[model samples]
Target: MTDWWLWLYVASMAGGTMLFLAWWARPCGVPAIEYQVAVAVPVWSGLWYAVLALGDGRVTDPGGQSVSWARYADWTVSASLLLVALALTATHALPRRHPWLPTTLVGLNVTMIAAGLLADLSAGSRSRYLYFALGTVALLGIFAVIWGPLRSVARRQPDGLHHAYVEAAALLTLLWIGYPLIWLAGPSGAGLLGPTTDTALFVLLSIASKIGWGAFDLARLRGLARRHELALAGRP
Candidate 1:
């Protein structure tokens, strides 16, 4: 059944991507490229989670002739992530540090994308080091956003709601990282404790991130509206 779960994961990811892209493309007015990339991040993230599911286990023959179902899933996921990253970069999302504090996030995640792809390629290597390194890079990328980018942004602008939004994004980023770890631990029958702890952490992180960032988004919007109203009244 890992194979079955793989298919399920793929289906859900694909379906979600299609739906989201369709919705994103529907609006006639041109949206900011970074915003578009931000919206698409979840889809790419979901696809990666599916790959993690596939890579968690193996099905092989007695002669050691490997059937590479996991590799195929990994390739698909890697290709998708690269494409999305490229799209984001092309749309000017990659170098977002301009005019604002230099966002190191794009640079960091680009490294992550590279490391993940390299690890996927070296899956046949005798050393599990490649896997460990890729995971490390990915995790580091997330933490950097939380610690470096979020902290700096919050400090520069102590606006509480703005801080909240950044925190939320950071939390979501962690969840995106955690989902795979949870699956790997659980499906491998490593024990309930490991998987449960990982899942719980991810879920909590996700919840906190959303709540904080959502409030920030709302607060910002409200501030904008109030300012606009004041300007309009002054003009009259």
Candidate 2:
């Protein structure tokens, strides 16, 4: 995690963010939030990685593990934004987004992230496992909502939009599973892996989940907009 590993991630993410903005011709009729998220996720994660690269935002826990709690901070904000972006896409076909589902999704996301953070912070204690369990429960709830209720919304979408929603949602959920598995394997939980390896995995995952994922979603949305298949915000 020390050397060019994280710095390269920062360069890719930050550079990509700038390049995406520079020659960016956002397709017409796409929601502005699409562009906003396309930029925000990478920049935010890169900033925190920059912080880690600069040797800040980290503390050695009692177990002698260097904990970059800033990664948790990064996840909290960026994952929330990602959830909103996905939620918008999920409900894009609906005439009006019910306030409850989006709000619940966000709440569950925050809870899940917060629980992971707490689990990491409470390392060397039994409660860390409890926190992990709670986070797992929250994760299950998220799955139920997205696959059950949100999938229902997807059914109402045009074919293109439905496929986009499925792609984004399924990838997101699958990618998310890697984090906890790594956490359990890395220095934080079972110590099967070292900190450097842990950090490297997180960096790669962030790149894929944020930068790569955003590109796919936005590209799909852009194509849908071009085809006049994307549902606008207010119109029934």
Candidate 3:
């Protein structure tokens, strides 16, 4: 309801629109399905935040602790898309192995994060700690998937794509690491931080994780395509 909240929402909407447009306007070079999913993730995330901002702001638990259902929803969709993108990238970059790993991990990650959010929304203080502990475990699992299988696949990629994948994954990991900290400082946890601070952090994290990562992915894919074309043409 404050000016900063309004501004943050507007920024989110704008960032989403720009990313979508960039995706739409660009010529397709990468695998269409994967590229589109990567591009769409951030756009959807931006819209979700925008709606959350324009709507009830933050819904509070029975104890008057604030929670953002919209954020949870956004994470559910966007985070899954992120994993899917990683999966697709891994499949493209490396020798095929088990195809089910990425999808399975995506499902688990979403469920875990969703449960944590639900626990955070409970009216009792015990649920708050439960949410924190649950979320920490979920994050560890997510990191394992990224660092283990995902990293192994990326290492097999060509140098450009390998570097891009590593950079994108690192960026995502860094940005996501802040979520529990933000939760701790937010109303759902210790109430050490204000709504404005929460909104600002979420907005920045959303843009970076979604749009920034999408850009890296698209660029990497395009670079891969160019290399393939050059190889076919018998050029460098």
RMSD of each: 8.0, 3.9, 2.7
TM-score of each: 0.45, 0.90, 0.85
Model 3 clashing-pair count:
0
Instruction: Compute the lDDT of residue 67 as modeled in candidate 1.
Output: 35
Worst 10 residues of 3 by lDDT: 1-10
Q: Compose the digit string of candidate 2's lDDT tens values, residues 1-236.
A: 35477798889788769755652564466766667777787888889988878888887766666778888888888887787788788777678866677788889989999998888778456988899999999988988888888778777888878889999999999998998899889877888987678778888888888877777777777777766643445433
Q: How much lDDT does each candidate structure score?
A: 0.43, 0.80, 0.73
**What are the runs in model 2 whose C-alpha is more than 4 Å off?**
22-24, 123-125, 229-236
Per-residue lDDT over 69-187 for candidate 3, one digit per residue giving the tens place of the 0 to 100 score? 87788888888888778777666656573567677778777876777677767877887687668778878888898888777877787777777777677877888888788877876
Specify the poorest-scoring 10-residue window by lDDT in model 2.
227-236
Model 1 over residues 95-183: C-alpha lDDT tens digits? 24332222354445555545543443443543334654665676576566556644554444325434444544454464456534643
In model 3, which regions exceed 4 Å deviation?
1-21, 94-97, 234-236
Q: After superposition, how far is residue 168 of candidate 2 from its true place, in Å?
A: 1.0
Regions more than 4 Å wrong, model 1: 1-31, 42-103, 113-126, 157-161, 177-180, 183-236
- Using lDDT as the measure, name the better of candidate 1 and candidate 2: 2
